[model samples]
Target: MSYIRGYDPETLRELVDARECKDRLDEIGEQRSLPALLERVWLLKVLGRLEDALVISEQSVRVARMAGTRKDLLRARILHASVEQQRGAFAVAEQELTTCAAEAEGKGWSGIAAFALQHRGKVFYDAGDYDAARADFKQALFLRQDSGVPDAQLESTLHAIEAADQRRMRASVAS
Candidate 1:
């Protein structure tokens, strides 16, 4: 069954229809066309349908693995972690991100490592562990900077740091 769900990206639509995505996944057989299937997964993610994304991502990972594309498999795993993070599955998200991070570090994929750090920091931020969040964000900032990430990402990460600090301040005030 192909995993081609009827996905409307508008948040208002919010119709991920995991069944549809799952059905469409079977469309991509062992023909060696990964990018197209990856597109469908990306669309599901853009539409805020995280569970669907995870499902499709898993399928893509399997395809990549069977196709001998280890990098793409790792990408799928990292993206799955992102979905978990969004769903507040913090520990699970950390496990995914940590493994990806380690792989990135070992493979010298600085860009991937930086992205993992940023996403992990977000998980920490949502968990209200400001200290851990700050550390993660700072590490991300440094990694991105060292990796020559674009200025836009740098600015956004800086804003995230500020936001994390403000949240910590609010918590202190409340306490």
Candidate 2:
């Protein structure tokens, strides 16, 4: 029932199974705790339920604001920005991610900053800004390396960098 195995960035399908995601959603039904809401938002987003994800993400943000620490609120905001990115709100997502990354960096939260940078890179990639995406991914990789994150996490950023490079090359060739 755990979804961690289904989140592999290196996989062709990104390791997500829609049916499993839906089952997890059902299992988390009406659980309004912050962690539950966060998980629900992630499941809904993965299930391609963007509107529902956005709603749940917003509620999670509100909950974090009311009952969580600054780090928790930032994490919620980062997740919210990711949903916005997936929903094609590139500008909004980028702005929020920029702010979040800056705050996290200022606080010496390398892992959080790397996470924000990685997600921001995805926004850039989706928006066809491959240069920016690569830059963000590289920065995230550096931060993660400095923090001695697991190899799997490092591999994710490395894959992102390669993807951005490939896309940029393809775009230039087409141009």
Candidate 3:
């Protein structure tokens, strides 16, 4: 039931078993610890439980605002924004990421700022704004590099930029 206790962060991200995460959530019952709630929100999102994920994300943000650190609140907002993005609420996701980016920048948390920018790029990508997405993705990659974040951490952003470039090229060709 508490199988999540055994999985390291890298393993949780790369090798999450949604069934196991779900089982753990069910067994953990009503006492949703912050970490557990965040993990469950992620797993629910991955499992296409969008409605459930959105509910948990909102709860996480609300709880984090009152009882968690700044970093925790930022992460909660990121999770909420990601779920909103998946739910086709691009504007909401963009707004959340914009707030996150500004907060992280003000706090000098370049890595988190980069992450928020990357997610904002994703919002643009979802909205078919390939040019804007590529711009944000490129800026995020630069910020991550400047922050000395690991290359692995920036890989997805690089890929997003590449995808946006390709899409833009195709659009130019078609027109």
Winning candidate number (lDDT) = 2
TM-score of each: 0.75, 0.92, 0.83
Off by over 4 Å in 3: 1-31
The stretch of ten residues in a row with the least summed lDDT in candidate 2 is 5-14
Q: Give the Å error, residue 18, model 1.
A: 18
TM-score (C-alpha, index-matched) for candidate 2 = 0.92
C-alpha lDDT of candidate 3 relative to the true structure: 0.80
lDDT for each of the candidates?
A: 0.72, 0.89, 0.80
Put down candidate 1 lDDT per residue, 74-152, tens digits, no spaces: 7777777777777779999988888887888789887788778777887887788888878888988988998997786
Residue 93, candidate 2: C-alpha displacement in angstroms:
0.3
Query: lDDT rank, highest first?
Result: 2, 3, 1
Q: Which residue runs of candidate 1 sit more than 4 Å off their true CA positions?
A: 1-33
lDDT of 3 at 146: 92
Clashing pairs in 3: none
All predictions: root-mean-square deviation over Cα?
6.8, 2.3, 5.3
